[model samples]
Target: MASGEERYQEFAPPPALRPFVRTIWTYAAPDPSRTIQRIAPDGCPELVFDLGAPYAEQGEDGVFRLQPPALFAGQMTRPLVMHPTGPTELVAVRFEPDGARDFLGFPLSAATDRRLDMVERLAGFAPPPGDPAGQVAAFVAWLEDQRRRTVWWIDPVVRAEITAAETEAPAPTPASARAASAQRALQRRFADRVGVSPRLLRSIFRFRRVFDHAAHPGEDVEGWLEAGLQAGYFDQPQMARDFRRFLGCTATDWARDQHALARAIASQARVAS
Candidate 1:
């Protein structure tokens, strides 16, 4: 792929901001000539600051539109394929399921499947060129300034259930009369603050778990099926259905294709500069 290679790294958030931020990261796609990467929903929202060449997004209508250098790319219900105009570099913040509502100071509904410019939204926080670390640090300062003004719209129980569900916990069902009441309350709070039902979030993460568990490099067909079942699938057939619904491919094909789920977002490519 020449210098069109992708290079990426992840960082932990500062302790004070750990409650809202998931992982901070920087990705560089040097000399990204004509290649574009496919980005799918991993059940999380992000704020991206592109510091290199801009990329073009392919719409459902088959048109390619240039993406803003700094923008809030909201939660996606489906896949997005972006075409790189040239070399690309970006620093990003991955937020927890219910984190962006307070961190970004807007309802999740307004940002879903949309791109809102960061400079216009944040007010005077423009990032200088080639400074990935500084970009994230500045956002941290903004968050710190607004820390006291944050509203606790999401209940702690709701946040806990969301975190559990995202980490591959089984979905809540009718356990008992009292337990069901608590479950319903959490579900309602989740939908209000997170903008989706808890069940849907659980399903998304569950699908992702199958892919992560099944991804064994250079494995044979039987190895693939065993991995999928081990990842909590009922059987091979159930896993195939999930792959089709979430990934538009069979589990067998997914294993053979060598497309890691991380490609849907970023990668740790070592480019030959």
Candidate 2:
């Protein structure tokens, strides 16, 4: 089996697609030793094209079922546990936080935490036929066509809220009687476009930051408590709460668990960035 870094690769989207597309990535591991991996939420939706054996995802009821060969994964609120049934080869597009709706032509909230058959749900959309690189090229061309046909727009207030959440800024305080109305409007716009409320997005971002700290500790960092503080948590207990809610495990337990594929992809992404 190839090493994780060698098995996975990421490519940049074209300049024209940068506003909507975060990245296009490929993963190929024909004989992986570690099969199961827990993938935590990252606030972005994805379009996945499986060129090799399909993966199986574990449901809340603990049953594992095969995933569709081509699928659109919506904004996820919880971790997704999955394992490849055979050889694994995939090409995927990761969209910006509020980008998927423009292409799908529906409110994003409808697909939250769900994976839909791409060709079935998306009229006139099909995976390009070719090797991974050729398929990516074809896919990019298709996206360019879609871009030309669609009118692109994002609510300014929702855009600002996404920025604030990513930066871990404190929630804004209502200044007047109309503030409540304005806040509701923001929430509606955000949910329709981004598939989650601003507060939940903020929490997810903070949780991911803390997880990153755990995955790659600095030389001066002492422990998880310090990591939590660095990640904007009030204390260790608060961090623990977030870990339980997002990962279904305590920080210590999660650290002890080996999620080889997930960890490797995350490390590669950090390096690429």
Candidate 3:
């Protein structure tokens, strides 16, 4: 089996493309003859565009399978969504919470099936012959066009209207001084539109955010524990409980898994690029 780093190396996105989107990546079959099994974990909502011939996706239940036509984006809760062992290439977009909200016409708090027909239409596109640069240019144009449409379709217009109706709608106060202001914005925005308060979102967000630090490979968990305290977790026990609840593992296990994957991706990315 290929390590996560191996998989990442095979599919790392071009460095030049990172600024345009959050971690856009492409994964291709590792060997021309062998199939690659992809296990996608529960994560931020994402869009996947197929660049090769269409392929099969095993449903969550595993009893059913389907061929995804070209472009699709939705909530992914399982580990193995696409088990493509054949020749295939994909472009994946992982959106930020607010960006996801603006892009999907829904909140990131829920798993949804959002299919943009235009994406598939564009995926069916054929890049000009002979120039790899031309093909990528064409694909980038289609991607930007869809991104513009998605942003236009959804913004906090409805939420803004509701906030306007309530006379006391607290003017977007800065979140508590104890918590990072950005964290507070994530909490408030999620609560207003997603129906869950930021406190709840923080439990999940913090669990994930620790990864930002933990991915460093040598950072001690003690520092993370202390950071959690600063981030407003009542205590280490409280933080650990939340990790088990949302991430399905203890902090140590979660950090290790992500670290492993990060290492794998970083190493493989060099070769893939």
Candidate 4:
């Protein structure tokens, strides 16, 4: 993170593209440090175009390499650590849950945990401009043509299964024999379209829900227990395990840390809650 105030802004795309694009954001970290940003899953995929200094993605092997200027990151089940070398500016699009599959012209499951270049994936497309606003216009032009020719390949059963899974929370998952068959079909189709198991998606949502609780004006054992329960965890132990699993940090440690992601999540979660 930059010591100096950073400029972070977000804008909606053209109305015609609203269904696919969640938002396009621009971040200008003019006075960047070697800040390590920890990214967690929010059940959405993204396309980020770097317009400033390049950043690196820390590998599982403890190595860090500069990320591609333009990359398509799929449904992330684990955390990603990013390190910026200097001043950094980013133009990024956070896609709607099912949006990336259609816009990217490929099943999302194939892209999980991978960083890819748009030019390599799609022909006749070049790297973007130096400005965020300009890049967006260029992207829109590319997408307009794609929208007319590309056909969405999602399976009907996969859609229904996901719908059921998303809605099943306050309710129980299906138990009937027919429902079991549907579940199996859903799993196969979903894996085809989204690339992750329904069970994994559920876990992502569960872990992310705790971000809101970090903003809750509570603390200690009692607050942790309540927060875990609210986030759909059966108990503190489960939530604690998840914090370690995805973030590699304990729940309490994360709460006490000074990170932009956690702070922003807390702020947004408060408003949403």
On TM-score, the leading prediction is 2
Instruction: Give candidate 2's error at residue 255 in angstroms.
Output: 3.7
* lDDT scores in order: 0.65, 0.75, 0.46, 0.68
TM-score of 1: 0.79
| lDDT score for residue 71 of model 4 | 84
**Candidate number that wins on lDDT, 1 or 2:** 2
Per-residue lDDT of candidate 3, residues 1-273 (tens digit): 242222332222344333234455555443433332333222344555565545555564665354564543543322333344445455556543334554445555554433333354554576553333454566566666666665433235434422332222433433454468666665556543433443343344444444344334555768878777765567888877755555445556544554223334333432332
Stretches > 4 Å off in candidate 1: 1-5, 152-154, 170-185, 213-217, 250-273
After aligning candidate 1 to the native by TM-score, how far in Å is the CA of 271 from where it should be?
20
List where candidate 4 sits over 4 angstroms from the true fold: 1-3, 119-138, 153-181, 215-221, 258-273
TM-score of 4: 0.80
lDDT of 4 by residue, 99-195 (tens): 7787776678888877777635445544354455766676677666777777644455555555554554432345354477777876666666776
Q: Which residue segments of model 3 deviate by more than 4 Å?
A: 1-23, 27-44, 51-89, 101-139, 147-171, 174-197, 214-221, 254-273
RMSD of candidate 3 to the truth, in angstroms, is 8.7
User: Highest lDDT: which candidate?
Assistant: 2
Q: TM-score: which is higher, 1 or 2?
A: 2
Candidate 1 clashing pairs, residues 3+ apart or interchain = none
Clash list (residue pairs), candidate 4 = 109-195
Between candidates 1 and 3, the lDDT winner: 1
